[model samples]
Target: MHIMEGFLPSPWWQVWFLVSLPFIIIGLYQINKLVQEKREALPLLAVAGAFVFVLSSLKLPSFNGSCSHPTGTGLGAVLFGPCIAAVLGLIVLVFQAVFLAHGGITTLGANVFSMGIAGPAVAYLIYKVGTRAGANTYATVFVAAALADLATYVVTSVQLALAFPGTAGFLGAFSAFAAIFAVTQVPLAIIEGAVIMLVFKYIVQLKPEILTRLNLLSESTIKKLQEAAA
Candidate 1:
């Protein structure tokens, strides 16, 4: 859901930067705290970042000559919370913009706000609520990941709608943009969710203790999940 470089004009770009700045600041702090307090989680953090970078870089063709791809932020959001996932997403976005030219530096703020902040926030919230409600762990993860992917595009559509409402106005523009994104995004989101769920399931089976240590999943919950999976 990269908005491309120079696509957003004038005040709109600046507005997005202003909107995304606080999350960046908070994300920085969260990353620092995570590093200091949970040194052992470094490898997993790297994996999460790599997941985002690789998946988001795929760039499949979409409507209106735009492109779509999996955000891949759900795993990190689930593991470390949305703030830390934002930091990972920022890093991925920067790298893609610089090297791949996949997205633009000018639109970095908007892109981050959508894919990093908004998407991960939704995933983190869904995960928390789902787990607390005693939903199946894998199903909760799947829904979180899928919805996070969709949420990124939803925010992107909003950003686009606000920037260029044209004659149709905000609501009309929003509907148009959202429809274009949904054409490809829905199936991609489902695939992303399934992939994330499988990865998380692997982690759950291999290192349930790590999840418990992070307080993301309890020992008893893990046990129940394993039993159910079996």
Candidate 2:
């Protein structure tokens, strides 16, 4: 969910902006490097951006200015990596803010941090662990996508609590925000996971070499996929 426009106080928003900027720069560099290396990956990158934009833009109603939606960063993280995911997520957020009126400029950094950096990072880690654990391809992708989406809301709740620690204090406010978001976000995340898994399955069937070229598909994963197909 976006923290909404003008919701964050001064300094807090500025702090987030400063913090997220470097990640975006790094993300840009990573993307450029990927492009130079694999020109064919351009279509996949575009699809990842579109996924983030479509999924994240579907806002659920909020009590306060904030609203919840799927971060959609995990798909990009799996297809590319966390750095590229962050860049894609940032672009989606900016587009949403300008045209959709969902998120605002004041809260862009906080939104990007939760949706772009934090969530995608978690997704990348989960993917690594899942593969190491020998989880099936679908299950691994699903877990990564779902957990990443949840992580985004968790970080968003924390950011909100930090910005406005009410009488109940930071932890209390954070819990409250998290609980509220869980109602809508959990289901959305599951859906997101399923969608990503299906998309990945289609990609695998169409062009398994793409993942191999990106260094994403390990030999073990390839063997598992072949076994599953067989």
Candidate 3:
């Protein structure tokens, strides 16, 4: 869900920009280094960025003034890590804000924080934990993607609540916003998870080497995928 242009107050949006600035800078640095070192990742990054751009652009009406849509950063988070996901997300958000005019420059920081940073960060952590626990590849991807989507909504709700606390206080407003979005967001996240899970499954089948290069698909995981393919 995007806050749209000029929806947020001046101080709040600037604060969010300040908060997200460090992460964006660091992500840019990491992405530059990665591209310079391994040119092979460039194509995958483009695909991932495109996924986020197209998927997130397809918004469904809900969440009061805002809208709900899939924040398609899960695959990138798992494959490229959260830092790079944030960078890709920045590109997507900025493009939408500038060209499509879906969201605004003032709220770019807030949107980036929720969809780009929070969601991908949680997804990456879940991927790490799930894989280390020996979970099935698709299952882990599913959970990671689902949780990442949920995390984005959760952060968005908090940002809204803080910005515009209604008759309900902060916590109450948060709950209210979450409940309102839960109707669509939860299901959307699940569908997104399943869809991305299938895509990742194919990555495992076709270009599993990419995962190995990212250090996400370990030798054992590759073996398991190969055996299953066999």
CA lDDT scores, all candidates in order:
0.87, 0.83, 0.84
lDDT of 2: 0.83
Q: In candidate 1, how many Å is residue 78 off? A: 0.9
- What is the model-wide C-alpha lDDT for candidate 3? 0.84
Clashes of 3: 0
Model 3: what TM-score? 0.89
How much does each candidate deviate from the true structure in C-alpha RMSD?
2.7, 3.7, 3.2
For model 2, name the residue pairs that clash: 1-67, 1-68
- On residues 87-136, what C-alpha lDDT tens digit does candidate 1 reach at each position? 88888999989988877988999999998899999999999999899888
Candidate 2 lDDT by residue in tens digits, 1-230:
77889999997999999989998999889878878987866777888798778866766444444455666778788777888888888888889899889789999999899988999999899998988887777889999988898899899999999988899999999999999888867877787788778878877767788788778887567767766867
Q: What is the lDDT of residue 195 in candidate 2?
A: 72
- Most TM-score-accurate candidate: 1
Candidate 3 clash pair list: none
lDDT of 3 at 32: 88
Across 5-71, the per-residue lDDT of candidate 3 in tens digits comes to 8888867999989888898899989888988998876887888798778877776444444456677
